[model samples]
Target chain A: MPKQVDHRERRETIARALWRVVEQRGIAHASVREVAQEAGISHGAVQHYFATREEMLVFAMDFASEQTSLRVAERVAELGDAPHPRDVLRVTLTEMLPLHPEARATSRMSAAYVLEALHDAHIHARAREGLTHGRDLVEDLVRQAITDGHIDPDRDPAIETNLLLALTGLTPLVELGVIEPREATTTIAHHLDRLFTNRP
Target chain B: MPKQVDHRERRETIARALWRVVEQRGIAHASVREVAQEAGISHGAVQHYFATREEMLVFAMDFASEQTSLRVAERVAELGDAPHPRDVLRVTLTEMLPLHPEARATSRMSAAYVLEALHDAHIHARAREGLTHGRDLVEDLVRQAITDGHIDPDRDPAIETNLLLALTGLTPLVELGVIEPREATTTIAHHLDRLFTNRP
Candidate 1:
């Protein structure tokens, strides 16, 4: 038999090269030839994997999203049966925060993808879908929290979900050290607490 | 007599070219030659102003921040004497949000700068300073709101200011239409009202 070739693995290998490029030189350096050089592959190999640069960018973004989702799922799986709704929400949303090294790494790439989403329809759709999925998940959590009497019953799940979703956008400030990690923690905590309280 | 050259004007023109490059092709295409071509100047002219690409990026980011500040100031100046503190804040912050066409344009460039700030120290400092300046202004408004009895008497101005400052980062989502303009307005309104209330 000829040498075995796993196309998926090769693609991921190329994607990792893109990640390395982003890490070392930022997305400005993630050209096809540059990524190919990083991956120790020929230009044809990169072309074989992605027909266009936009396709490669889309795949990289999707790959990053899957990594983040896996990290969240891994943590969620480790939770005990019927964990406090607040704690579950916090832990799940923590992956969206740049409070940890892993989340910070993913956020680095995610931010670039967000900027790209402005000019690219595929990226905009993917990002919009990702954000919608996140907010829907938040709505479910809010409902669960309300049902468990862990949060205020009067909260509008839609707006509340957006509020929580918007807080994740603050991660770059934290990553930049403009806002301390403790401050970001406090802000997120305050938002969650306000949701739970009925006092106004 | 020798012709007089305004260095500031030259830099701004080059920065405008960078902005146009960002606007037309995204920042990924903002190479020195491209920006020089866009500015109708020579590559040596671009090199003359900034020794390195990083230096040029810094200048462009600073230029954008200055542009944002000027727009905010102009809007504030348009308001009547002692306008409602809430309205003042809403209008000022609306500039920071991608709720309008102009803001969405600046935000396109801004989000790209933010993503770059994560890896570049100089960009990080510029971003940090800009954010700190914003929060300080928010603190001033929060103080005025409290003094004027427009907001809660016991609110932590620091946290409230941070909350408002962090909200500006959500412009990318708004640009992507992940958060509709009405929703963003509602979110900001809710946040401002919460600050003004004794809500827990």
Candidate 2:
């Protein structure tokens, strides 16, 4: 009997492959042929799923975002009931960090998209929208922490969220050798401690 | 009599034009013709100075680094006898922020090169070396602050320096709408205050 394949699952698998290529080789090299090879499919099969390179990139970005959201939700769910706001914030914030392999790949792909976005308005808009949604999630978490007394009530949640997201951008800078990794991690840890310790 | 153009000065002027084109239109769009048009010079004149687009870009990066060093040195010199490390750090770090028009343009050009550096080894190495030098400057400032008792002696200067540079990356992220600008600034202010004040 022939192996059964879910079309949706197959598309997602192909998207993942394309994302990895973008992350490792850069968006400029993420051709349909390359993605197809990475996905262990024929170039024509990849073309069948994604008519154009732009379409593949767009789908890949969406796939990455969905994966990110799912991971955050999973981590949040694992906290169970009456979780400390700090713990909630840590899990949420760390999910966005390039600590895990998947997150690291996502970060690289996102960074590549940022460069591509400079020339492509459609991609730029999508990237900006994704970033806004991510920031909103962080803001919501910060607000929850403030209300729960896990963070300083006087602290501005919006600003705190923004800082956290900004910190997220640091990982790529370090990875790109623009800054030292140790320095980046330590600095982030210090900032988070001060931000979450409920101290003035 | 016709105006005499100094070859060295003209070359520098051409490099600045390259920077501006990259800043406004992204690095990929910064061709010899575009740069020459922007500089109000002949396309042949650009080749006489830069040989190729890559050479022009490399020269521009060096020029930017030199300009930054001079500005920081001047600022430090202005602080002669009575030195407030907090104030100095604030001013220096703020100078790096894309708050002003010129700084914003410089930042865009830098970001464009950063994307190029991802694939180009020579550019990547130069970026790495320059970044290391930047971190060293920040580290030196932090060390001075420690000696003067502006920052807590026990506080890790290296980490603090990294944090400052990380914040630099964050500024553009905010400007690009990848993060909320208000939130980013507030977070940075809070972090800086904590770093200098040693408050929890």
Candidate 3:
């Protein structure tokens, strides 16, 4: 009898291989043949899962976003009604950091896709959706903080949301050694504290 | 007799063509042959100036950085000695925005080079140098703001510098229409005003 493979497991394996290729060679090289080689499969095998390179890229980008969301949700769940907006924001934003191998790999892959999106409309649309989703999550958290009286009521949610996203973009720069990590972390923390703290 | 182009002018033309190709077709298609065709020159003609694709990329990346620096320097020069630090910072950061076509093209090319830097060591080195130079400029401005009593003396320069750079990275997202441009601009302006204002 032919060997039976778990379909979801195989797809995950392929996605993981795609992430590695993106991380190691940049997304420009995340072609079918390249990802197949990384996945220890034939190009046809990759085609079996993804009809086109765009399909694979879209799936991979979505997968990464989902993973990040799940991670943040898990962490937030653990927070268990933490009233402090700063604490909630810190946990959510820091979860996106490349503090471990998994997070680092995901970040590299996501960054590659983001750059790729600038060139490909399909990827661009998906990236926009992902960005909106992520921004919404952070925005909601900020709103929650306000509702809980953790953040200054006078603060603008729209401004704080953009600031948080901007800070998140600095993580890959730090991971890539473009900025000193300690300084990046300290700078982000200080800015966050200022945004959250009460001051006359 | 064949016309002889000035070496510096030839190289600059090739770099501009490279950037145009990047903006038109995305960085994924920025090969020597394509760039040469875009410049209406022979492939060998491109090599005459750049030697190799990697060298071309580095030169192109440097050109973009230089463009940004020149713009900022020109604005700073106009400010003279009595310029407000807040105004200087706002103007300098705004120069990095993809508000106009030239800046937009440059921003696209820079993003392409940034993705390439992830996998190309030479490109990565150049990117690191460019980022460091930018950060240094921001740090100097931050220090000046403090000395001018435009910002809080207790505000950390390092963090402020990162915040400024992070804000630059977020601009493309807005320009690309991945995020609402109005929201981005307003949010950035609000944050900068809050961060740099002396009145607290």
DockQ of 2: 0.41
Candidate 1 clashing pairs?
none
lDDT of 3 at A58: 84
Kindly list the per-residue Cα lDDT of model 2 for residues A33-67, writing each as its tens digit. 99999999999998888789878888888888888
Candidate 2 chain A weakest lDDT stretch, 10 residues? A1-10
Interface RMSD of 2: 2.9
Total backbone clashes of model 1?
0
Where does model 3 exceed 4 Å of error? A1-5, A77-83, A198-200, B1-5, B77-81
> Residue A156, candidate 3: how far off, in angstroms?
1.2
Deviation in angstroms for B111 in model 3?
2.2
Candidate number of the best DockQ: 3
Regions more than 4 Å wrong, model 2: A1-7, A10-14, A30-54, A71-83, A91-101, A178-183, A198-200, B1-7, B31-44, B70-83, B178-186, B198-200
TM-score, each model? 0.86, 0.81, 0.91
In angstroms, the error of model 3 at A160 is 1.1
Candidate 1 C-alpha lDDT tens digits along B26-54: 88888899999999999999999988877
List the pairs of residues colliding in candidate 2. Answer: A159-B183
Candidate 3: the clashing residue pairs are none
Shares of reference contacts reproduced by the candidates, in order, are 0.54, 0.42, 0.62
Chain A TM-score of prediction number 2: 0.84
Supply every candidate's count of residue pairs whose N, Cα or C atoms clash at under 3 angstroms: 0, 1, 0
